[model samples]
Target: MTFEQLSDMIAVVENDTFLEAAETLNISQSTLSKKIIKLERELNVKLFDRSKRKASLTEAGRIFYEEACRLNQDYFEMLTRLKPYQGNRRQRLCIGTLPILTQYNLTARLKLFTEQNTWIDFSFEETEEAQLLVGLRQKKYDYIIARENLFSKLGCVSVPLAEDELMAVLPENHRLCSCSSVKLTDLYDEKFILMNAYTSIHQLCIQILKDAGITPEIVRTGRVESIISGVAVGEGISLLAKSNFRIFQAGQVKVVPLDPPTKLSVVLAKLAGTAQTDAMRIFADYMCNGCEV
Candidate 1:
């Protein structure tokens, strides 16, 4: 009926003597006899034949003994699986970032952390600025990294990672490609490919243009690659983070620094007041060190 009673039954059958079984179980022979009696009464079946001096199993007793052994094994396995969660030794980490980080292969740097910590399962999500903030607030993601100012009103804690300098991607034959650095004012009359206005980078570009006292002719609004491909074809020049330089082919575009330089701070943001788990701390450290560009 109970696990202890089932165990006693097994010991009695295995040892073939009530006194020996009681000694093995560290209980008195009378106590073991009562437990076995209780189990037999609960099942309404005879477990052992007392006609002989040594105990012998009934057909029903053999079946119940096999089943109890299996149940005991399964219970141990379940306990092993549950121990980690019970002891706070296991963790699940969800990291979120903007597309720019993925394009630059930032996740590869976390390889060591993943390999070293076998008990922690990790997943990465790439999202836009607004969606990333929403996920962090909803507790769907543990951390997010994006262009600096994106977390301004998101009520999250932001840590600066690096200063990402904005650069101009110019075609090899473009006139400004010869200049070591291009000023924002020089692009006033130039055709430009811009990211969608809804993006944080696009908003930063708009601010930079405003500061330079010029309005760029918006050729199109789309992703970084699309803009870079347009620039490669001489359709229009575009501004991009220096990290994106690796995505463009060597001959396709020339990366020229901005004159009177403008830069955006790269930041890692997390839900405010969220406990900093070991996995989160390792990831943050990896990002801060691995993001050399």
Candidate 2:
């Protein structure tokens, strides 16, 4: 039985009548009777003799009441012992971002962050931009790094981090690989390897390709690793943000700028109107200055 029901049963045992127990528990007498009846159904035995002028407990009811009392005491004791650990949990902060953003530079910066903030614990989640916003709203993450407008539909806040231009990642042996840069039309008729729909880049790149007056052929859609792999093996050439260049390995893939560069604004997002703890504010300040570093 639930702890609530167990406690309610105990209240009944301590009082002289159902009316008295209901008053003590601050619940209606009807609700109290129903709870006891439910308890009896589960036990398949009578807990109260209804025919009595005053409510009286059966033999099984007396034994169950005593056990319930002991259980209630133990539950409170467990919470008392765990109180310290709960405080420790509150001292931790979680950050979430896309796998692409965690490339060489940001990864090194994160390592330094943890080293400097030794007093606190940190957790990280790498996922698409869509889930990052959801995590922020659900309080699954204390902070998120993603496209600026991703949180527009949400009531959360975001500090602009950096404006990164979109670039193309092509196979080393591709005809356009030798070019200094590529235009939307340059990639015409070329099969594209793209990230899943949850990623802002997926929609951004598609629209850009279509605006260049070509029907984009999406050969595949998946994680950043899969997109990079597709480009490396000549499966298809794909476009990604310049800041994410570190996620691609050299020799296998060549990163070239787009002729008409398109910039995407990155931001650090959090609950808009919430009070920030000292640790959270300090961490957010560091993230806001990402472009300076």
Candidate 3:
């Protein structure tokens, strides 16, 4: 019925399985299944054969899909032809980002870009890494600024923007605060206050601990601000990027570098095969040229 449902159905047929389609669309399998079911109910005809191991399209589905594909192509072509007629209108560029843009010092660059490019209107949505990918795939965002590890295997074009090291964040009075650096083993038995599981930092923390054969007793998980406040109040220690220390109140927490630094790479990513608009191409070049990390 809708463009999204049509696209989802098309993905299942092209990929030959609901699971593959879900992955390709950056949605859960159950969500994809529900969409297809809802779409079938609307049309009052089964789109896929349930008995097949693969997603086999029914006769009705084949007819619908062929027309859908043609319609989609015509729709895009119409938009392309109309682009030249919209004179002097501000172009819209929607961006998806992680919550740590300020910490990474990328906000200043973005602001400057906006100032110089008066003809482009920018919209930013901050969410978890997982949601960023989903938004990009769903065409909800033109681009996403996230950690490189997230889209490395997802066939996205990534331009590295910045880098920072993960460190130990603790209350000013904590015993380890006096040390220049702390090892992962030193905090093995200590209570940890980490960011939510949906964040890249949370996964990094868990992986580092696991690699070192340590089981962290994580007492709390929350947003960046909540975790920082918890650590300040001595709720528990936490691991965070070094650049993040600038955001917290001075003298409230002590941030010491990890013994062997763990680096985080933040990149500007977009769907690999998407056609680059003039605005997109210019912004990409500007950001890549201006960034040092």
Model 1 error, position 190 (Å): 1.4
**lDDT of each residue in 29-71, candidate 2, tens digit only:** 9999999899899989998877968768889888888899999
Model 1 scores worst on lDDT over the 10 consecutive residues at 79-88
For 112-193, candidate 1 gives per-residue lDDT tens digits of 6676555678888887877887898899999887877777776778777667788988888988889999988888888889
lDDT of each: 0.80, 0.78, 0.83
Model 3 residue 3 lDDT score: 77
**TM-score ranking of the models:** 3, 1, 2
Report the lDDT of model 1 for residue 236.
88
Candidate 2 TM-score, true structure as reference: 0.59
The number of the candidate with the highest lDDT is 3
Worst 10 residues of 2 by lDDT: 81-90
Please give each candidate's TM-score.
0.64, 0.59, 0.65
